[model samples]
Target: MEESKSGTVRAVDRALDILLCFTDTTDLGLTEIAEKTGLHKSTVFRLLASLEAKGFVTRDSSTEKYKLGFRIWELSVNLSQGDDPATILLPEMERLRDILGETISLYIRDGSERIRIQAVQSKHSIRRVAPIGARLPLYVGASSKVLIAFADMNTQENMINDWKEFIDISAYKDQMAGIRKVGYATSVEEREPGVAAVSAPVFNRSHQLVAALSVSGPLNRLTLENMKDHAGLIIESANRMGNMLR
Candidate 1:
């Protein structure tokens, strides 16, 4: 019984490791996966075959590269159906959109990225690319900062170290400090070119950051001075969203 349990645990660990490898890259060959996960190539192939049979993985017949499969999407659909934070927050976000006359977005952390779950657009002609299901780096945009501010220390440290490609940690840290002091963050051209956003964090009953809410508009319309003016309103809207979830 002890040997059987040990074998089962090892197999489960390897399966989880194989699933995680799919998240780090766009596509991976079997050899590359074996190298990354330290599994024998034959063992990896068997695991991949099992996963493919269950629709948890797919192999490119031409290139032999493995990618995440449709089952992952199907699972996400079920998860999104009930207990979605977005569904709990959208009505408040729409009210924010109408009040601020800017695009309002709701985001949550998934792994190392912030995923936009909902966006309510204002009536303005200027539109943005922050549609539902869009992903953002954890150290760049206003929403991202709200996420980092409330993440675990380890994730925060990793983001602070590796996020220079988008925004430097020094700048983000300074921004976070200010947001903590003033209860909101305002960014100019952080994620989108010629766009500015003002964001605040949404907290769960446990005071964890379940999501972030942001109002975005063109730089000309949503300048730094203008953002400072609207900071109170933005924070209030976020507080209302946070309350609804609780």
Candidate 2:
């Protein structure tokens, strides 16, 4: 009986690992999960079968890709939303879009990269938006700057020191300091030639950086200085979004 219990525990551990492999991405195929967990294809298949049976995951027959099921969302909503990232904060993003008439995005840092977990696209014909789930570098754009600006000292130092681009490092550091002081960030043509954005940091209850919330549009509709004009509003909205996380 003890040996049987041990085997069950091992299977449970492997199943949990398979679920964790989907954390960074929206969905994954069996082979992708196997590669991510370093488990054999057959083992991954069996684990996914159990998860699917329990409604912890769902697979699309057309694509054969598995996505987190409604049960996962049910569990997440029970956390008082303190640790929930995207869903609870989406309404604030929608509100910003209504007022700003531009794209509003929420990005969270993943190491040296930032991922857009939520986005409300502009209704205008000429608006801009980084697709949801887009993983962008932390070296450019207003949201990127805001994420780096609010990062821990070691992370900031590591990122800035590792940068090898054309921009001056000292100036970049100074810029980050300015962002920290002002509680917001702006960029024009930093990542793309005709894009502009203003971003503010969103924090969790512990004051740790949770995400960077930004309003973005084309250069003709917004400029670097003009972007700063929305800083107060952006920061306010970001703060409210942060509050919702708690």
In Å, residue 95's CA in model 2 sits off its true spot by: 0.7
For model 1, residues 182-216, the per-residue Cα lDDT tens digits are: 77777788767899998888887677788888889
> What global local distance difference test value does model 2 have?
0.89
Clashing pairs in 1: none
Off by over 4 Å in 1: 1-82, 164-171
Consecutive 10-residue window with the lowest summed lDDT within model 1: 1-10
lDDT of each: 0.81, 0.89
Top lDDT: which candidate number?
2
Q: Report each candidate's C-alpha RMSD, comma-separated, in the order given.
A: 5.4, 5.0
Once model 1 is optimally superposed onto the true structure by TM-score, how far is the C-alpha of residue 38 displaced, in angstroms? 18
Best by TM-score: 2
- How large an RMSD does model 2 have? 5.0
